[model samples]
Target: MILTYAKTLMFLLMSYAMAETEVGENDLNEVSDQVYGVKINKCCELNEIMVDSVCRLAELLNQSMWEPQFKTEDGIAAALKYFNYVTGVPDCATTQQRPIFDLGKSEDELNLLTDGRLQHLIHHLHSSDQIKDDPLITNTYSIHEAIAIPEVKEPSSYIHDQAKYCMDKIIITSSNITGQYALVCVPEVIINWKETSFLMKKILNPLFHAIAMVLYLLVAIIYFVIPTLRDLAGNIITTINICLIVSQAADLVRIFTELSNHVSFMVTDIILYISLLGAFFWLNSFGFYIWKTFKSRNVFLRVTDVRKYCYYSSVVWFAVGVMAAMAICAHFLLDSGSNPYKKMRLSNTIILEDIEQETIGWLGIAVFFTPVAFTIIFNLFFYVTTLKVIKRINIYGRIHYKLKGCFDLFLQIFLIMTTAWLFLLLSWLNFDGLFYAHIVVNLLQAILIFYVCVVRQSHVTFLLRKSCCYAEPIPTGEWGDEMTHMNGGNY
Candidate 1:
């Protein structure tokens, strides 16, 4: 009786172990199905689907109490152990075969069949050609045979082929799984090329602009200290540089702070528009100054009226400010949501749409871009007229033998205006190559100003050299008079 009772207990334990193994197999199948569904629904690439499915299955195993007797610390290790046990094969770490199913074989036979290789299968169930030709063998054989069979033609090809039928099967199963939890377990999606391009622009814009600001600030200080550099044109250039610096600085701040608050966003927007308007006005001023200097043949304006220039510039600045303000107000009024200026974050792509639909948006865009466009056109006209006037004066011998100098002046004005216009043009076109070119040219604005206003002007260069060499400072009036005469009264 004692021996019989002991035997009965042993039999019961064996039955329980078998039952647990079967339950573990069922659990793994369910997990695999969920992972396959996630892959299909997301429409992942071939290799991505494999990696994602494996990772997802591991995640599911970790979350559930599947195979409690396996005694592994985490899901990935548990999965690896489970694969080893089911295949009756040791350390199948790199094997690509389907998950193990019951084969009604002894451990020795199973080991022989798998060649003791532990398989971690990523089956491309969509490839119909990989299935066996015999209907009975195809329907009854393990899914692992598609990958494991030595006779299978091009295993890699089979793995890469789209899993259409499997995808459909998984999709059908997904509807019953609440919340589709397997998706959460997959690895984070990799950023595509489009997102990478935007990210690069975001990072580089602020960094390059900040460097430009420092250069501009240094040039501004030089203008203040060097007496010969202090002139109407110099002052205008300095102001333009300052405005650009402010605008770019505000943009940098907005990028970092994410334009989180309405007040911050509005302040940044207003400052940006105002500064941009100022830059356009300054460019126009420079163009007009060149035209006026060449046409009237005087370094100083013949009328000696600076107030008119100031008035015109102020009108432009204020008009743009008001328009920008109205646009902001309209955005708030029309959006009726948490973040009105959220669209502005992707301003290049969506600003046109805003202008078409929103009243103030159109007005604001018109006020800003219209002035810029007109400035380019007017500058071109001024440049051509100035060139004609200079040529006529040279032929008549009214201006001294400085035809080369006059030509250089024309070239400088043309280049400055053209470069500025190109930036706006490229921005509007939104081509990757053109956009990057715009950034390069835009950042060089300060250096260009320094070179044109300080380095190129003989009087300023003389003063800069003298100051650097610790020589006595030249009288401002003497240098100014000399430069006036050198340009034939057209500095």
Candidate 2:
């Protein structure tokens, strides 16, 4: 009886244990099903959110382009928020809230948004036929690219950085999903109202500069070869041409190479200043010489010594050099860990900085351009005085001679210096006319110099006439007082 009872007890214990095991297995299966269902639902919800976010972004971008008063920063911020929410990344606002212009806030915002995944999203959006076809979408995308994209050394590395950086920003939750990635790019923007004028300037400025440089070089070479061409005017013109050539050559280098260092920035800055200051100085010298020539006509009756010319030239060069040096020194002293010349790229056939801060802010402007401003004022005064003298002489006698001289002088002033002043004014006012005027006038500076000093000169005409067998050798005496004054006199 005792053995039978023990067997029954053992059998009951085994049966109960087996039943508990079955129940536990069933509970586990049910829990797994619930978990899987939750995952699918969450993923579906995320998909819906992403789709909605994308559509909203597209709408915001379109609105930004269409609405003239739309704040681009606000639009970008809103788009970024939506993008973050959909991508399982925290919104920039939640992470750090501040104004758009706040440097630290801006940097943080950019870091949060610029992950590889966002870049991938941008690439996909940009490549869509619908987005490409829509002008509003295209322009908005361009603005984002300009403001958001970071420079990377390698294309593949950009992708890797994007992925790694984005992952760092995100928490590795069980529900998260990884996606394919690609790079993004933005096209430059153009306003429809000013498109024609801007485009013309963009195309013509470089073309004209190249043509002018070649012409100046050829003319300078000719002046060097011909003994008769060697004079005070010729020497000044040659120096001006050399400065211009160096400046233009630097400009070309900027177009080809990305100048990211302080040395290149300083060199480019110096070269540009020298070109501009040198040209204005020489123009002023011409005006001064003309005024002096007319004033001393009867009293002095002779050209100023070449030594005086050299002295004047040295003074101008030294002054410009000082200004350039000051600008460089200021940049070094007031660096503030933010350089004005950084991440420069070739754009519209010119080297342009992606971000341009004043060299030392306002101080830089004051130091660099004060002398140029004074020079411009003095040149203008000289020009007016010379014109008045020419008019006075014409009233007394030599009407034809005075008229020819006045016309030549007028052309010289207009081409060399007047246009540059006009550019400054128009640029300050942000006038649309500046686009065409600046390109045409500034790029053709060398050509204008050539015309004033060589093509219009009587000596050149006589030489050309003789060489071409178009006329016999005219006696130097019969060439008129204008030619004699221009050749023998310093004016």
Q: What's every prediction's RMSD, in angstroms?
A: 16.9, 16.3
Q: Return the TM-score for each candidate structure.
A: 0.48, 0.52
Stretch of 10 with least lDDT, candidate 2: 96-105
1-491, model 2: which lDDT tens digit per residue? Answer: 99999999999999999999999999897776545421100111222222211322324222221111111322243221112222332222211111111011111122123221322122111233332343332211222233333453222111112212212111111223212111122122323434454355444556776876787786677555444445455555566677667766654444322232223544665566667667667666665665566666562332334686688688778877788778767666764444342232223332122322122333454566677677677767766776677667633434245334544644474456556655744653545577567667666666776787667776665555554565555334332334545554442
lDDT per residue as tens, model 1, 340-449: 22221222232111100011233444455666777778878887887787667634432333323434544574476468656856665637677777666767765675
Distance from true location, Cα of 97 in model 2, Å: 28
As a TM-score, model 2 comes out at 0.52
